[model samples]
Target chain A: MDSTIIIEKSVIIVAVFALTMLMAMYSTWAERKVAAWLQDRVGPNRAGPFGLFQPLADGLKLFSKEEFEPNTPNRFLFFVGPAIAMSTALMTSAVIPWGDRLHLFGRDILLQATDLNIGLLYFFGVVSVGVYGIMIGGWASNNKFSLIGAVRAASQMVSYEIAMGLSIIALLMMTGTLSLREISMQQAGMNWNIFYQPLSFIIFLICAFAEANRTPFDLAECETELIGGYHTEYSSMKMGFYLFAEYANMFISSTILAVLFFGGYNYPGMSWAVENWGVNIANVLGFGALFIKLCGFIFFFMWVRWTIPRFRYDQLMHLGWRILIPLAIVNIIITGTVILRADIAAYFGF
Target chain B: MSTVLIIFCVLAAITLATAFLTIFSRNPIHSAIYLVICFFSIAGHYLLLNAQFLAIVHVIVYSGAIMILFLFTIMLMNLNEEREVHRPRITRVGAIVSFCLICLVLIAIFINSKPIVGEYVTTGEDYQSIKVLGKILLNEYMVPFEFVSILLLVAMIGTVLLSKKEKLQK
Candidate 1:
């Protein structure tokens, strides 16, 4: 690659990295703020306006704390668990299309890091592997609570993953492509998919909540039952990594939700802006629009977390296997029938 | 081209080493983890071959889902290194013999086949794309595909039946 192209890619990679880190960091502050607001209390206002620097303070505190590892035989795997968790959290951003391509310096640069042909599958693959982090960490801790938490997390993720994949299949049938970039592009000009595939969107949203281990679905880390759950034995930055990875996952999940169901970066007068303003301006606006959508979804995640109580463990499993799975299957059949309505009509002599 | 070769060599080495570890590791959890590493290496090889669809699916199905279940089961059973019972001498001998025979057959097949000694040229546009794969699977392998789905449904029903606890009415 030419030096200019290399420089362009480096800049984009750095920007995406910074954006993901920034979003995750701020999500902690946002969560606490939202939670406090809902309970009618002042949330951290000691550091900067509205506790803007609260995340930084929290990071410093975590870093300063002592790191604790249990007396487990598998020392190596214990160390590797959080590293896996952190890396996998960052990895999913590679395939997400942040915005349409930006035209600048007489060359077009795709906003995504790399759009693999199998973007959707790559997403699920990375997400499914994320379970290893919790499993290894909890197992290596050699504590019953941690192990129980890990097992709960693993089974919960596995169950929700089926429903998640099934729900996506319905959306895939409607979109007819696996690449997230293609899906976003197809939903251009105010044709956001949520209008067409509302059931798929609802199922996907619920599954996403479970996959991210947010409240209501966070049976693995229920404080009263599991006593800190999977990260019970973790302290210092190790615990910070687990918490950070969850927020990072939530951010990515929100971005995925927006790109899949919402119009992504496609705005109502995008064509007008491209004609009047310019490609670069339009793309920048589109990026901002996408960011706004992501923030909205992130807010929704926190809102639900504060509003809803945690589900009991058995109830969680029942919802996953007995309810969501069957509902998702029906959604798929309905989506398929609707898509091929003309053929079905012809077969029935409509 | 040289970079791809280097990556492929690294992946192949890891795949072989991990497969051996998976077979020989005394700790069941460690063995499961080694098998996951082996699966990931194989997926890397799939990527090198430009089979993106197969690579991701291999990861999701094998390393992600199957191995997690394996690790979960090992943990649930509370299997530890100290409690692992040794195999009989005859079983060890038999295993060695079968392993050697498999290696010999693999070598024989390798020697008879044309060796790939040149630059890799990947041709065709979107040959492994989702649309192409879906079309081929539905049209060409439709029977087997449907059979697999039905088989999975039956397995699910069997699991529910087996695990269901009957009410002990007094």
Candidate 2:
């Protein structure tokens, strides 16, 4: 690669890293704020105006807290746990196309870190590996509750990942490309996949929740049962890392949901805006559109968290294995049939 | 000397060291973790070879899914207290014989295989991309692919049957 391309990519990577961190930080504040609002209370107004700096305050508190470690022999693995969680949480944003290309400095700049051809699979790989962080952390803690929580998380994530992958296969059949940029480009001007593949979208959305270990499916950390779940033995910045990773995961999954089902950076009048306005302005608007969709999904995630009760362990398993997986498979079959309808009609001489 | 060569060497060293650590580690969990690293390094090798799809799938299947299950099983077993296993002399001799025989066979195979004479040549073909890979697997390797699926299905059915039978006994 040329020096300019390298520089561009590094800048994009740093920007995305910062953006993910910002979103994750705000998501913490937003989760509490939204939860409080739903429950009819003032939430964190003491920090900055409207408690915007609450996350920062929380970070500082975590930093100042004493780093507590359980008397576990596997100290290295215990340390590796949060590091893995934090890194994997941040890694998923690499392939996401934040917006359409921008015309800057007389060069067309693609607003993504890297456009891997198998971007969807890359996302899956990173997400699947995310289980290790929890499993290792929980097991290393040498606590029965932590171990149970980790096991629950592992089974839950694994079961839902199947459904998630199947649901995306349906979308892939329509888009015929694994590149997020191409997927986003295909969804230009109100042609979102959600319109056509609504079933897949719903399946993917639910699986996204399960995968992120968000509420309703968050049996891993359901305070009533598991007592803080995998991070039961964690404290100080270590516990903070797990919490931050969860919010980061929620943010990434929300972004993925928007990018896959919703039109990503595309809006209803995107074509008109592109035709009338310049590419930079249009792309900036597209980025704003994507941001709105992702934030809306994030809010929806929190909304469901406070509203819906956590699923019973068996109920969670039943929903994933019996309901979602089969539904996702059926969605794939239906999508395939719809996509090849003309060919099938010709074959049947209809 | 070259950057690519340096990266390959680093990955190779990681792969070998992790593989050895996987075997030599006292704790089963540590072994599993090392094995996960070994799998990841192999995936890195695949990426180095420009087989991006293969690399990611390798990571997903082996390092991600399989290793998670392995760790789960190990953790559940709670094998923290190491126990010494006493193998009979004949069994130990047999194990050593088999290990050496397998190593000899692998070495012979490598020695017999044709060696590359020059720098690796790029065919400049779209062979490793997911689209082409899917086309090739469905078209040319259709029978083997279907057979593999059937094998997996059979295994799944066998597992379900075993578990169901145990439940019925209870």
Candidate 3:
């Protein structure tokens, strides 16, 4: 029985890993396609039909490119930077529940890599360490531009994270659980948290944008101003790793947003479908539903990237600290009041 | 049980080695990185105890926020070449003496605190989950919680005041 469980878990882990990579790979393609369509230009169409093989081609190019490095003293840290970035991006997928469960071989198989009790916090922890990648890479390069970019990335993340965490606290108070799976299950049958906590959702979305270093919040790599920002000194696959990590981070952030707010894997009439079609098919559909949600969120990310202009550094900080933090705190207070309304009403004889 | 013990030993080794490296590393940035690894190793120990919430929070607060800020400061100061060259040999001897004294003190504390006849018992995992931790914190530790918030408020005010530039009177 234990061995069977182990096998099932191993299979799920491989599947999740492959799926994350696949999504991230396509996200790069989709990003370019979206950008092209947005600007009234054809994008990467020369590399296989509709640029489907563009990422593969890009990968080969990056691999074949010269492994360039700045004449810096800290070569170890330079190499370690992308490794930290890639690993942290991948680590977040461990706690996220991809779907409900599968009933295979007469036993229930969990879709998550691991159902960590404090999954949300685990996600935040991984995200926090993600800063090290950019910082270490930039600093090790010993380039002024790289250093400035790393500093910007560090401060911007620090600011946005405060607001992000505060907003999540409000949601946590409402849900009363830290487990992502529990949060996902709570949003079953259209009782999405976004409906009740729209303010928090907006805060989270903005923070997600910032956290993933997406547009408007992508001051870290503002091309014209910083000349590739933190990665000005990096080249070849090391540079590719940083860029790939960003997309991976985006994928994970979208998945988190989907799970946290958008009724993850919970479509309308899902319970009915399960009753009629049995557990396996129902779960299969649920997984599909989650994929659909993830795609929608990924597309949203791309759409915003092309549409919105990047924020000035000071403006980003002001939004994160001056506006979002206060708003998130207010949200928490309001949520707390609503939660205790019954008790308050009882006391006041309402 | 043996597997858990082995894991614990590995984590302990990592934590101790990283902690030592954190202090002894020549580069300030390398020291900061070592500190982060040390923090992660400690977090691993927390996980073994099934205090998952504490483990992740430790990672977030220590490796995430604190370490990032530390790294930022180190970079901003350009402290890569921070090794002291003009320090007198006497000061180095004094530093070594102090370090040995602290080590001796820590060993004394460890030896004194260990119970003679009691086997360490597991706290059985239920207590450290976020929900229970929250309940206990809000109910029993409410005063300290409020106090901490006030302390943070004061610190924030102090930071703003300190960082803000004042206009000079003509």
Q: Score every model by TM-score.
A: 0.91, 0.94, 0.91
Worst 10 residues of 2 chain A by lDDT: A335-344
Write the candidate numbers in order of decreasing TM-score: 2, 1, 3
Listed per candidate, the RMSD to the true structure in angstroms reads 3.6, 2.8, 3.5
Q: Model 2 residue A268 lDDT?
A: 88
CA lDDT, candidate 2, residue B143: 100
Q: Which ranges in model 2 have alpha carbons more than 4 Å from their true place?
A: A346-350, B80-123
Q: Is candidate 1 or candidate 3 better by lDDT?
A: 1
TM-score of candidate 3 to 2 decimals: 0.91
- Measured by TM-score, the strongest candidate is 2
Error of 1 at B33 (Å): 0.9
Q: Which candidate is the best by DockQ?
A: 2
Q: How far is candidate 1 from the true structure (C-alpha RMSD, Å)?
A: 3.6
What's the C-alpha lDDT at position B88 in model 1?
88
Model 2 steric clash pairs: none
Please report, as a residue range, the 10-residue window in candidate 3 chain A with the lowest summed lDDT.
A1-10
Better of 2 and 3 by DockQ: 2
Clash pairs of candidate 3?
Answer: none
